[model samples]
Target: MQVVPARRGRAVRLARGQAIRIVNTHGSQVVDTWAFNADDPSEFMSMEHLHASLGSVFPKTGDALYTNRRRPILTLEEDTSPGRHDTVIAACDVHRYRSLGCTEYHDNCTDNLHAALAMIGFPRTETPSPLNLWMNIPVGPDGQITWGEPLSKPGDHVLLRAMIDCVVVMSTCPQDMIPINGANCLPVEVHYEVTG
Candidate 1:
């Protein structure tokens, strides 16, 4: 298992048939995840497409995560949590922090994604909506959403298998201003490993 340090990110390469096990090591961290086709960075995982394909805002085990071009990119083969992962919220960025009253620079998932990909020599400029692992954004009957605390316990994991060769990026979201990470508003590290 590899550690995605608190408020940081990591990137990994995956071939078709391989799977990545993302562990909620701390139980409270929200790992913003994204995937892009290995041969074409422009083609990436799309949350909108996934919502349409799944016919629901929440993805569960055995669900195929789709891409912008309406093709399967990753499959959620397993999940060991309460199944409250979020699909509606956008990845937190500098603008988001500014709106939250931050005056100085803030660490965000957007920057983390770019930095992580660049580290792997797979630079990408677009910031697509991520599959927020363990995030809890409850939708009310009136269609309103509320930022809720994570429902996963420590050691919970989600296994995602690649449908094609791709680059997967994960950011341990650094949103200390909100309780999205948890009720304590703390950001922490998580672990992940690739398996055949």
Candidate 2:
């Protein structure tokens, strides 16, 4: 198991047929996740395309996560949560923090993504809307969305299998302005491991 330290990010390269199991070590940490083709950075996983391909905003186990080119890049092979992963919320960034009234520099998922990729010697690419693992954004009947706490318990995990060779980035979202991580509004580390 590898630790994605609190308010930080990690990246791993997975070949086709391999899977990564991301564990919610503390139960409330929301991991903003993204995947890009190893051979083509422009072909990264896309939330808009995934919503259209799945005909829903929520992805569950057995779902094929699509990329910008409308092709499967990863598969949601296993989920131990309540199937509440979010596909609509954009990853938190400095701009978002500013909007939330932060005047100082804030750590965010957007920067984390770029840094993680760079650690692997990959050039920075456009930030795609991430698959927010364990993020609880409840959509009401009135078409309103409310930020909710995670329904997952400690040790809950989501296993994503790469359909093609790709680099998967995981960010331990640093959104302390909101209670999306938990009622305490604290961001924490999570863990993951690559599996055959």
Candidate 3:
């Protein structure tokens, strides 16, 4: 809760022993996140190990998150307001724009993710599965899924602590077709704190 304010078009970096909390201040903001080691760029985050650590799902508060080498990377230390954080959600990409009914969404979240990855010296991969922090996409009994109303109210946040010297970059999603981006498409604030 140190509240280091981050803005749009700029990326924030955090070191080991530091815990950061990001807020979806308005409502159901969608955040696409990635974690990597400051020591090595190749030491990336792996969803496979992440699934193994928390059973194929995204972590809530107190869940441990794993790295590509199966090492402890982050722990979901806090969730002030609960929402459906999507681990299985696909990142928006050009292919998604083409196939998922709109090419206009090209310069969206997936592109931002790729930009962030490339800024960190990683080759941008295609459509990485995302961890939708505050967005709500409900799955029905028939396995059909749809975006839901705003689950995170203003001042609601999720906190994460780095186990290693990890760099996290996020894109506050700007999709308008769904309720995934809080139904308003606003900005979010990310803060860092060294809490060893």
Q: State every prediction's TM-score relative to the real structure.
A: 0.99, 0.99, 0.79
| lDDT comparison, 2 vs 3, better candidate | 2
lDDT value, residue 190 of candidate 2: 97
RMSD of each: 0.6, 0.6, 3.5
* Count of residue pairs whose backbone atoms collide, per candidate: 0, 0, 0
lDDT of all predictions: 0.95, 0.96, 0.66
Mark the regions of model 2 whose C-alpha exceeds 4 Å error after superposition: none
Query: In candidate 1, what are the lDDT values of residues 142-165, reduced to their tens digit?
Result: 999998999999999999999999
Q: What's the distance in Å from true for residue 173, model 1?
A: 0.4
Worst 10 residues of 2 by lDDT: 115-124
Predicted candidate 3 versus true structure: per-residue lDDT over 85-155, tens digit per residue? 77767766667657758846455676676676676575545444656676677767798978666577777
How much is 45 displaced in model 2, in angstroms?
0.6
After superposition, the stretches of candidate 3 with alpha carbons farther than 4 Å from their true spots are: 1-10, 103-105, 117-127, 184-196
- Superior candidate under TM-score, 2 versus 3: 2
What's the true lDDT of residue 70 in model 1? 99
Report model 3's TM-score to 2 decimal places. 0.79
**Which pairs, if any, clash in model 2?**
none
